[model samples]
Target: MGILDQNIDYDRPVKLADGVFWVGFADLEGRLQCNPYLIVDGDEAILIDGGSRPDFSTVMRKVLQTGVSPRQISHLIYQHYDPDLCGSIPNLESLIDSAELKIISHADNNPFIRHYSVNSPLLCIDRLERKLTMRSGRTLRFFRTPYAHSAGSFITYDETSGILFTSDLFGSAGAFSNWRLFADFDKKCLGCEVAHPERPDEHCKETASPCPWSGMHHFHRKVMPGNRQLRHAMKVVKAIGATMAAPQHGSILYRVEDIAAAIERLQRMDDIGIDGIADAASCPA
Candidate 1:
């Protein structure tokens, strides 16, 4: 939860890569900016992580602005439900006219997704083989990082763009203003020095006492249990040859060293035994 220090075009989709767009919505204060990605190739399209129930109209409006018809989206890849991920399933199913709108996710997501609508067919990803090739010549390799945040948490890697769509790992706060088609590794390396952010409480109240962003520290702790899962996730994403890492909540990471540094930072967090679980009052933000 970071509130900004710069300007951003929050009403529309922001391009993150060739054929890849960030089509998520945010509150006016830019605090609850849950991110979703749209990947398009010719007439075929894929959507990753639809925003929450309240975000349906804005998300769809921004997405439709990109010229992708609902029928063209043959695949819906939800990272996890948790309101922020698959809350728009009901709307998407109604809006998209494709009979082939196949869903791909962990089996644990079946109940949550079907709760919205029983019509969206789900295809579970294989952990061993770990890859799904779409009819449009795009291959999505899956990584089952169970319990990293959610029991069914997993990630996808796009072989074409060399981009890894990790659900929550390596996420940072205050992404709306800092977003770019590519990661600004140099500026991110300096952390909150680039932008003087205020905590969500102070930000909402329009108060002072501005603080420095801990760089995914709060998110990792709140969403993830601890280092045991993080270590395994690090190993899963380690050395994947990903040119950029797109997460659900943070700005995408785009440089080799930047990605590596993020891994190392998580490694250090684990070593220090830091935690961010909401109920754990002992853990500091």
Candidate 2:
């Protein structure tokens, strides 16, 4: 994912599924982009990744645009400790006027989120019950995947939607400023007809490809430690069999084929260590 060429489609929030919406934004100062998901269930609303601290206003507005108030947010799930992944959490606690707010993450990440999750008790999934059943009967399964980018990194799989919220595991570089949502993109990939062939990748020969391999490759190499850790994580991702994958970075991925392509590509790629700066740059959208 090279610098995401700005597009008008990502200027507003878009619904990804029945009760799920993808609210991604570009950081004006950093020029990087991050995606946060809003999951609404009966009497419970889960928000995945709250953008960076500086991005709280924009992120919250997008969340509210989904007709979701802070009071409705019950759980805040963190995929990892990256500023882009869980940075806005501090602001969210102050912004949300809720009383029963609960934070969820891998047990190892408690220390990292302890600062902002003061008001709410953190329920570390790998430490406690693995499955969380919401009031809506929608269940989420959590997997402990450490050392991809951080030791407390983890992934959450939503059984209800067959979508897995992978923190940094399946992320690609660049923001999806000029991209389509999962359902539409999935249909194109599955049918071998890409809506726009302009995506930055030549890996897939599909016409007008939807696969963002170029970005994915750049991201994984720079972040992940090595193939060992990544391969172990990929096994878990493949076993989960997520039909749609939502990463803290990059576009929302739909369709098993496209998802598999990412997994396979990462599995075969080399790793980079503590790179000076990420291939993605902060630029105006």
Best candidate (score: TM-score): 1
Cα RMSD (angstroms) for every candidate in the order listed: 6.2, 7.9
User: What are the TM-scores, per candidate, against the unseen true structure?
Assistant: 0.79, 0.79
Off-target runs (Cα >4 Å) in candidate 2 are 1-9, 26-30, 174-211, 272-285
Instruction: Please give the range of 10 consecutive residues that has the lowest summed lDDT in model 2.
Output: 190-199
**What is the overall TM-score of model 2 with all chains considered together?**
0.79
Backbone clashes in model 1:
3
TM-score computed on alpha carbons, candidate 1: 0.79
**Residue 200 in candidate 1, Cα distance off native in Å:** 9.1
Cα lDDT tens digits for candidate 2, 1-285 = 211232435556666667877777754333545788888886568888867877778778888887888888988888776667677776888877567888888777778777655567788886657778888788888887778877888888888878898878766654344444442343334333221223444445553443565556667777787667888889889998888888876666766787887677666654444332355235344
Candidate 1 ranges with C-alpha deviation above 4 Å = 1-8, 28-30, 127-129, 173-213, 271-285
Residue 190's C-alpha lDDT in candidate 1? 36
**Taking the tens digit of each residue's C-alpha lDDT, what string does model 1 give over 25-138?**
755454645678898888888899877778889888888999998888888888776778877887888899668888888887667777766476787776436687767787
